[model samples]
Target: MGRSRPGPIRWLWYAVGGRLPDEYREWVLYDLTAPTWVLRHLCRAMVQHSVWLLLLLLPIPLTLRIWMVVTGVSVGLFFSLAFIEDASERRLIRQGFPVGLNRKIREESSGAQRSELAAMYAAYYTTEPDV
Candidate 1:
């Protein structure tokens, strides 16, 4: 069966670290485990940063405000990407998933690619003694 998704308002709340309803739990797992999960997470981070950017409406010059917003978003995205695993895991936990479940799901989903890479690494990097 297809998973149920949250509405826009619920999604906005979810993007800001709010827990989703039980009906959306399966969708949340799929979202975090899908191949495009990293991109999805980054997109959510952008949404979060954009919301915070709204606070930059001060008496400052337009160029200065723009520069500050840009800088803030850049830093936020960098940190978000840096800590993506932790963030995603925390999100999963908030939705009633166990710790490390995200990693487990990702690893399982990418098993074929991982095995292929491991084979390539063994062939290219492992040294064998002369027979």
Candidate 2:
């Protein structure tokens, strides 16, 4: 079946932890499993934290508002990174995928690159003793 994306409004909701309709299940799978999934996750986290920007509407000094938004986003990003795997899995689950499926799919998708890296590491880091 073809992957179907949600509309912008639906996508924003999805980005902030809301569940998408079943029609976008394939797109959600692709989103969480694609090669750049981590980056995509971080982008979603940024969007989630961007509510801090609303501080700009406050009567506070411009610099203070900017700093508050920056600090809030920075802290949010840090926590997001710390819980990225769990969060990704939860998002997948919300979309009807089983738990741990994200990690399995990621591992399977990167198997070739991972094997190549292991081979390269062994070649560079292992030494043979001369007889």
lDDT of 1 at 4: 73
Q: Write candidate 2's Cα lDDT for 1-131 as tens digits.
A: 35567889998999999999876766777787777888999989989998998999999899999999899999999999999998988987886666776676667557456434323332332344579
Can you tell me which runs of candidate 1 are displaced by over 4 Å? 111-131
Per-candidate TM vs. native? 0.79, 0.79
Local distance difference test, each candidate:
0.76, 0.77
Clashing pairs in 1: none
Model 1's C-alpha root-mean-square deviation from the true structure amounts to 12.0
**Which runs of model 2 end up more than 4 angstroms from their true locations?**
111-131
Model 1, span 1-131: residue lDDT tens = 34677989999999989998866777787777777889999889988899657747888898888888989899999999999999999998887766787686567557456434323332332244579
Tell me how many clashing residue pairs each candidate has: 0, 0
